[model samples]
Target: MARDNKAMISGFRCLCAFIFVISACSIASFLYSCQCTSPCHDPGREWGQSLTPNQTIDLLSFPEAWNNLNFPQVPPPWRMKIAVFVKKWPHRSQAGGLERHALTLHLELAKRGHEIHIFTTSPINASSFPKYPFPNLHFHLSKPTAAGYLDQSTVWDQFQAQNSSGSPRRPFDVVHTESVGLMHTRSRKLTNLAVSWHGIAYETIHSDIIQELLRSPEEPQAYSLTERAVKVVEEVKFFRSYAHHVATSDHVGDVLKRVYMIPEERVHVILNGVDEEIFRSDFKAGKNFRRNFGIPKSKTLVLGIAGRLVKDKGHPLMFEALKQMIRENAKFRETAIVLVAGDGPWGSRYRGLGSNNVLVLGPLEQAQLARFYNAIDIFINPTLRAQGLDHTLLEAMLCGKPVLATRLASITGSVIVNGNVGYTFPPTLELLKRALYRVWSDGRGVLEKKGEVARQRGLQFFSATKMAAAYERLFLCISSMSGGDTENQCQFEDSSR
Candidate 1:
């Protein structure tokens, strides 16, 4: 009986291995097909070669001398009636990265005299529906699902009604969706629609792998490779329903064209941007913030991290690295301080390192976040997720603080362009430890200089104004194309002197 049971167990193991091999081969073949059939196969051309001059400006320098102009300051040649679809808006305490992005982008667009209409889920607190801050910005609220996501059917109904009203002789000049509006986009052909992909299933698969690899052996795995493969296939098909795609990072844009088979012309790469007005450097505010937190002026380095303190956000990497640093080096334990701003399961774990080493401040408001960024000498984002670029990293840089982040393509390719701006390490405890030690060895003055470099890069590429301007150009180009203008005429004119 024992011999028979052993044989059965061995047979089961063999069967599972066979299934995994088959699944992996299937995914590999699909990716190979993408590469063969897409522009990626062309040896003479580059990943973004097919993009027009305007679309490549963010990734490559402009041919002409460019001036850093604020989007709101530039008067639009013509006002555009725009419809935006997003899952949620910033209301009360429900501010996530996507919500903040939608708010920032639309606010800037509205300020520039664009008619902005937002279709989003109702606030959890029904009475918390605030009045519109801008006359051109209107909101069409839909009841949310139990999962707190927007009701797609309800949003579609509202959108259709607005289109049917015909108050404006023409329909919306351009429709923008922030990783939402799938129901509406899939239902019909909307020539002027642009869907911004914050993260795709292919990227999520990479994230899941990183999370699983980093997770402790005792922790139950949260992802199945087989399931992820299936989901990626489904996502590639579903994405084809949209007319245009906005990739939040260059790496993502590359993936959209090379792996997802999105046409290079249809994919636009725009890095995530932060509100420079709020997050810019302020030495006085930094000093005040440190004093309020009771951090001593003598502390050699004040390292900080903000955003959800969840495992996927790479808290485990920071927690483990810092804990080891304190345990191994008495000088580090005494001289360095880590400020953790945000709430999650890892909050208690971070606090477990003790108040002397790590200050676990709960989730902070935007104003407080600015102060937090200013207070820190160096910002550390040990995130494992390789999807969208974290706004916190950009915010920190805008506040003139350097970053030590994971070496993800999205971040390394865009945000941390060079060692002068910041440092990066592979997602491993040993590499992270080495990177942290380097930061400690370099000290404050060196890091501050790096921070200045990072701030300059942030202003040029990742500022909210820069982001809005890119979107503005894209919207106008899309509108022009829909009106039967030639693609060459849609080229964005650089108004910089």
Candidate 2:
């Protein structure tokens, strides 16, 4: 039976590889035709306007005004009709990092008066659509599959009907896909469309390698290295279908440009952001939360790990490190307690460590997440996945808590810019143990100071306002190419650039 199963898996892989090669060859001509005919490809065209060196820098780099920490909200110069394509809308019960990002970013955009249309899969419960506070925001739901994935064809059909239905035929100024409109983009090319990539195939390949290395000898590998390499090639080819790309991290932007061969001008980096109002520092709230949970004041160093507890999230490493810390160091067993948030298979395993050592909080709503962040001394994200930036780290930082996370490029380059904000270690048992020990030795006072720095950094770079402004700027730039009024153009320039 085992031999037969192995043979079937091998056959499937071979079939997939063959299909990918054929698809790549088939799309080569289509991609070439797009480049030749697309206005975005012509350097002399309006969409391809030559930006001044300073304007180019401003578009690419983080603005200096953001460092002030009191940077005022600047409304967009003009409102727009934005079509958003995402897999799911965030609900109180079920919101992942991507869902939270879509909610935060588009809400801010809608608040600034953009007419937003969200096209997504139907809610889990048909009768319970999420209600938002924004007036101009509208939703178009496509029936989901049994497994809850989006029906891409239905979504695209809905978008087409809406795009051409109005009396004067109102068209969307710009189309934004949260990595869900690939099929539509592939079906027909649209110059004004921009796709935001949370994670790409190259990153997934790296994640696969990390997972395989971290897996126990008793476990079987999910995909061999060759299979992952084949998938990467397939993904990179498909990625070229979209004219513009939004990379969620600096590292991802670099990968899109260098590894996937996306043009530098077509790739934009906009780091993920959190809600500042909700995740702000509140000592009283933290104290109240600790008390409500019956945590004693003597527990000086409270460690937290949020998000899904699956093995790919690096929970195995965290479990091993925490277990070792509790067993070896008597001080940790007494002075520290680990709070595990979110739900997955590893929750029971964490509980097996004893309730006294690890407190399993399961999944939390946004408000509860704010309290959870404040109640802890430091946030630990031992994620092995090196794809998108994790929002929990930013949320914790916004709440004035330092982070101890894996030394992935996304975290190190974007999240933890300096050593003072937090600690980072390679995703290994020994290194993670050493990092935990160091945090233990530093005590709560040192962590508090680091948390303060982290708060400022989070406000400067990871605030919803900053993220919204950057995206609005990109939208304006893309929309202007289609001959909007001069007043609609992006006129705001940063001299500091």
Candidate 3:
């Protein structure tokens, strides 16, 4: 009996030591991820956070070496180059949604051994883009055209001088343009051309501007008028040359097809995705984040919002809902709190209101923002309207938060109305109030269940791996278009309702 007891004690000691080693390594890995300042880690993390993969696997983990972070069995590094043309880049002060997406796509391509050149107009706001973390990425300031635009020939000539001294100039493996109104060149001259439409084109703006101009008497505005007209013509001509078109959302895809008569086969949809390896909730972080925000532990209730604090994002709607909730029941005032993440034109205005319940955390990097997801019982995306799928909502979902999204065109009611994940509402205060009440009544149970469902859905349909694979296939198919005149101006009747 004495010998058996000694053996059991020794076994326990060994098990404890193994657990200690795992705990120590896990903590160290988390600290490393938290300290990472790569543009990839730019804007989100809740304080002192760490990441753990689904099975604690290091495959595609955060804080990874660039070359090691990619899909399993990814194509061997190929000698390919693609240029991403955009009007602005992040940190250039012109930082907006477009710039963020540009960085994201560039980073993804660079990981795949594709040389990426980020070309942009002379930023209106001096873009102090963070020093790129990846060794393979490059940026160039294209010589401006006569009108100071990044027209096709402007970039083509910029590359012309650098051409290899050999027979048949090596055509670019791909020319990818986004947001910028890409100037189309002739099909035979170019091998691979792609345009990523963020939303309705500058031509959409042109039609509206032209109508407004014609309404008023031409006040010697002929020079500016004629110049804009010429630019529009060039843009249309340029678009016809795009062999492959990409859109971030179905709404934008529909707009492109209707506005430019693009075909369904030619346009590809690549939804923006969150980096889950960074955004996963510290399932253990419950209550800690709430305490840091000074909320009492008794109430399992807090409202959360993230994104630009602009009117279009529906900040006022949230304000109205709060007022209604306060008036409806004095009890809710004690239980509810709202934490707004992100800063923009209206952030100051909301701060000025000085509501006791609203905590405005201006803007946070990606991983830091995950804590806000950790802190709150519910997430609200009251965008009155949106041009594309609000990726903020997707991130919230990834973090296991139940979303309260508006029934907007981009986030169709059908897509978000799954009872287990979130609730959809028309842009009305009453509807918002009702939704909040339902969420608050049994908030914890409802949110937990919905969060599980969200994780499953995201894994199955919305992962970066899935999105990248889709694009890979799309790229392969587009590169094979050797015949058929893709520029035939047949009027496109959009069937993508």
Candidate 4:
């Protein structure tokens, strides 16, 4: 009986040891699986951080070296040499919307591992633009003529010389130029040339003419008559010089096909993008930004406008509508303030109309402008031009501020929906006043909700990442088609749009 009991105890001990071993194996497997999945899944990080010596040697042949910072998933590097031409670069002073558009899009492309060469005339405000430095990027500045214009031939000649070298070492896969870059557009060497149209210059001239008619005849002309006439002729010739065109909006695309007679197949619509990283919602930032400008916290609403403060920008119309609103309503005069962020000849003309309600804080740099957008409750774009949507609208919307723009087809045709992101009013004073009163009476919470919706839309549709990807795809598509193959011409349009 004693021997049998001892044997039973030994059997129980063996069973207990088996159970402990199984649990240990299970825990070890679980931890091994988690480590396998968690630590090395990031593609950018893997490329940047864990390259072998041979891989490092391969990557070193290219200009973009692997860095520790993990970037968003970018396209497989095409490693193509690309040349870009712009009338003005956003380096010196306050760049116009077009210049900013070019800079932002190109910089994003550079980050994605393309070799980029920028050719431009020296900025008019050289003091404001120091030398810009970027890895895998080169800038060639052409000296301006005594007449304060970049001589197109000088740039064209340099481009030709570089491209004609026939050395595989200096091969350029594509050339990109702005709409105003007439000489570059005429390049015969690269069939893969593209022109980006920010706005139709003829339409701009027409709008400026109408604004001039509204001004007093005694007021000096905005430009000498010869300069005005010369600009019109230049625009006509430039559009006729047709290359593949990129229009920043559907409205601009329509204008390209209809007014400019660009072939539908030749024109691609790629909307302008905003840097979502910079222009994002910050409730706490609002008070700080306003405080910097001496605006009181008690002010119920702030209406902000950022762009050139010129007649063609529809500042006069905006002032007329605001004055009429103030005269008709007392609450608007007391509760709301207008912050104009730009500089132009029209700044001093309508300074005293608002009785201290309007504050024109001249041209702001991009960083200050981001803060300015955050400070405002709503953005008002009263532009009366037939020109396409402005970049300011996207920037404001990205910052979670709903935009109230004039209901021109140009503004209406973009991503903005009436009463969803913001409201749009007719250019008429009565309509503007009605829109203003509606926002004023509904309270700030209503606007804040709409601003949230605007931000969501901006994230989905107008991000710089998406924009750069679209352009890259288009460039690749065009490069492929330039090789005696026209079958895939529409291959990237859907992806880009």
Residue 53 error for model 4, in Å?
A: 42
What are the clash counts of all predictions, listed in order?
0, 0, 15, 0
Model 3 Cα lDDT, one tens digit per residue, 52-166: 2322322111121111122333743343555567765666323456666666666766767766666666544445446767776777665456675675666666554433422
Q: Model 1, 1-497: lDDT tens per residue?
A: 99999999986776586467556745865776576654332322322334443342331222111122223358577888888988878874347777788988888889889988899888767788867668888899888888877787787778777765545565788889998654544434788898887877777767877888887889987746657766677777878788888888766777777667877778877777888999999999999999998998768889998888888889888898899999999999988999999989999999999999899999888889999999999999988888887899999999999998999878876777678888999999999999998999899989999999988878877788888887887788788778775553244433332
lDDT (Cα, tens digit) per residue for candidate 2, span 1-497: 99999999988988687566545644763575466543222322321123343342334333222222222366755678889888888888478778888999999999999989998888658778878788789999888777676777787788888877554678888889887544544434678888888887667766776787788989986755566667677777878888678888766776676568878767887889888989899988888888888887778889999999898899999998899889998988998998888999999999999877889989988888899899999999999888888999999999999999998877776778567899999888999999999999999999999999999878878889888877887788778866555653434444343
List where candidate 4 sits over 4 angstroms from the true fold.
Answer: 1-73, 124-128, 164-168, 205-240, 354-356, 484-497
Error of 2 at 251 (Å): 0.3
Worst 10 residues of 2 by lDDT: 62-71
**Residue ranges of candidate 2 with Cα displaced over 4 Å:** 1-72, 165-169, 182-188, 484-492
TM-score of each: 0.86, 0.85, 0.68, 0.76
Clashing pairs in 2: none
Candidate 1 colliding pairs: none
lDDT of 4 by residue, 299-408 (tens): 79888988887766788878877777767777777888888888887666556765368888888877778899999989988787767558889988899989888776
TM-score, structure 4 vs. true? 0.76
**True-structure Cα RMSD, model 2:** 7.5
Q: What ranking emerges by lDDT with the best candidate at the front? A: 2, 1, 4, 3
Candidates in order have lDDT scores of 0.78, 0.79, 0.59, 0.69
